[model samples]
Target: MNWVRGDSLGHGTFATVNIVVPANGSTFFPSPAAVKSSLSHNAGLLENEKEILSRLGSSPHIINCLGHDHTIENGVEFYNVFLEQAAGGSLADQVKKHGGSLPESFVRRCTRSIVEGLRHIHEHGFVHCDVKLQNVLVFDNGKVKIADFGLAKEKGEKHGKCECRGTPLFMSPESVNDNEYEPPADIWALGCAVVEMATGKPAWDIRDGSSIWSLLVRIGVGEELPKIPEDLSEEGKDFLGKCFVKDPTKRWSAEMLLKHPFIKVDSISFDKVHEPLSPPSPSTHFDFPHWASTVTASLPSSPYSDEWPGWSCTPESRLRRLVTDKRPENWSELDGWMRVR
Candidate 1:
């Protein structure tokens, strides 16, 4: 089977998935060393990643696993793991396309999903050391799933090296200060993700890289953070502030974010604002072939069946609704296409 290449939903600095045929495609990070090797092995970070994904697999908030793509041929190979696709797009794109500022209520819903995914992984004895807008995947049906296992760690495990594996802007001060880190460190990253989504750019993106770390250091110690636009709702600012707590444990959890009052105030037509087939610029990028087949794919109509492999969450709902629908009889339809919203 071949994954239809829509656009890059996401790419890992350490590795990238080939995006074969698009319902969630394979994770090619630990791609086989060579076809010569049967049962090819993973080395370095890839090995550590294997352990993390094993733990995350136990969580429902994370992507569902279809199985590892270990098939190999002469000089050719497949990815190590396969997962469901997020047809909606990444949180990064959503925030960008929506004018760098999202409604306070929407931010709440997205934040709730993030914390839930974090909670799910951590409860299973793992920490998603890397949490950021780029790592959070959203679907049109309002479902959100966490991705990027390269920076994850299990509970009780000793902190690892301080190498820069995650996006610099989202790195937690605790993670940078100590060579060895823990779950608290991840909470800091989550704060950055929330702030960026609420404001449209990273918390420290405006600063220089070398100095940015220094700036984060200041914020880590309870220094006054930069001003959030006044026009943003009070509820939005409040939600953003909750995650910005200097102390990681004190920060809100996924369940708490879901219930926050800020996220409850949706615009009159907020749900309707995210209609499919809308134009996507640099921001609002998507990986859903269903939308792409009509807009960018330049096809006369949707190529896949209305009820093919994707989630039951309708594209019309704008991903505000949770896709509680149980598994369809089949799910491989979303396998290979990457599209922009």
Candidate 2:
């Protein structure tokens, strides 16, 4: 029973919960009822998570957004979200404990799974602005899932551009620049994930996560991005390089990276190009940081590169002009309106 305890779980910047309640679905009863607290009161705030999750059912690699409720307790209003619980904990927590990144093969598999989740979301017409290891929950089953749709948006909705919705280390160069962003933006974050898994630590998670205003100012002016590790293999470095591009157009598509030698997926038959040298496990070993060892990488040209207007002031950053089947590679073309349930 993972119950929501108002006394402990109900207070956050975007949401307010006085307690946590038991998740009604599972009866194992290890903790309180699970309640996913919202960061905002407007139902629209959680609409993106609602939209993306509604389209995706149960998958081992994706987090489950079960249900939600807008209620009042002691005259205080709050939105209670019922979601799948991950006891093993978030990827960030694990990376911090492990000291630095995972093996290349391990990163490849995990990155593939996360990209799969992003592929599903992008297939529908939504953009997950904030993609990071912290939002990914690793379960005891060795599965990975993307969580936290707090910063997602529809194709062309007119919301403000979020110059910095995610953690600094995991943020894309475009995010730091406050540029007009789109699906590729998530790809950029995915690149950072590659680094995180490769090194076990986010390049800049230690920096200003709280100074939004100052951070935005720095990002828009091209504050130098922290270097990723340098010891990574050519394949590992090349793959992440494509994802870190400042221009959304240049960012590698999930389809493209799936073919990279450094990426591994169990879906491939054992005889594929080359089997993963050895399966990634707790016993994997490395000589040194595989990626960015303090080597600062400059960003590429931006197609829509412009100063970020900030999420609160950006135009058409929402779902207004976006049609279901606008871009062939976009999400609306894959699944229709039924995905929002």
Candidate 3:
């Protein structure tokens, strides 16, 4: 693809992201895109990410890959992949701007979008081993998508017994212990991400301390789980409880979590086709706050069946309502999560 490289977007461990524009002035993308590229000598990770994005195809909740090409500067070849620009930046940046914690309603909506993306990834038989707030990109329209799949792998794939692939703060019990993981592990990380989104802090107390060993021991060996924010709604707490299960086998799957009440609250009227929100002005960049409850309150309730997945907590109350009706016989007693068959 012919493009003119622009300013640096951000720097990663193996790649430098930059803004890129089409050289021919064709309207391929309405706005400039972010290109992630690295020297050919260190292209393995970037190439793997490009291949994974290609395989995933077009997904509403996953970052879009415009295309890829290569360039040679100073006799060194560099591989570049163009991605849809997220003008609003990352969830981490947003969280920081919001003074470290986003509102519960915004967290619910953002988490719902990420869950949709995870469902797509798992359905395609891939596991996004790194599912954290930093990797979630946001658009001006208040939409979020999952990005950065360099460490992703196929389901059931094995890794070096001692090798760990994601941020320690969001690592799953299995990953901290055996270096073995799957899609369920991503859900565990998702739980941690939700806590960070809700509380503006890491899920564990050791995050600010200098004890990686203590943190790993607490995650892998101890029966302790990350603390859920008390300020969250009942559905939000219950949702994290499902994702934070000690046993990967019992943890909620992305597909199942999509059915949980927290996400369902966001799904109430989101399926309808709505035009994307206008991009926020680049000059007036904001870090990380979310739309208020009034925006969500304006959405119409969907016409779903009474037996719909996690509808027990529904009265169109926007995720804060209690489960007044008897739970379907299949709900789990341990954490109040709906056990999807």
Model 2: ten consecutive residues of lowest lDDT: 288-297
Clashes of each: 22, 59, 3
For 186-270, candidate 2 gives per-residue lDDT tens digits of 8877886777677765544334223434433444555355456787888778777777665677778876777766665543222
RMSD of each: 15.0, 13.2, 18.2
User: How well is each residue in 175-237 modelled by candidate 1, as lDDT tens digits?
Assistant: 445533466656667767767676776565353223434543564555655445456677767
Candidate 1 ranges with C-alpha deviation above 4 Å: 1-14, 22-50, 58-60, 73-79, 160-165, 208-229, 253-259, 263-274, 277-341
Please name the candidate that would achieve the greatest TM-score relative to the true structure.
Answer: 3
lDDT of 3 at 205: 62
Provide the lDDT at 275 for model 3. Answer: 36
lDDT of each structure? 0.49, 0.52, 0.69
- Model 2: lDDT of residue 43: 44
Error of 1 at 217 (Å): 4.4
Regions of candidate 3 where Cα sits further than 4 Å from its true position = 26-30, 207-209, 265-341
Clash pairs, candidate 3, are 94-287, 94-288, 100-200
Residue 236 displacement in candidate 2 (angstroms): 1.2
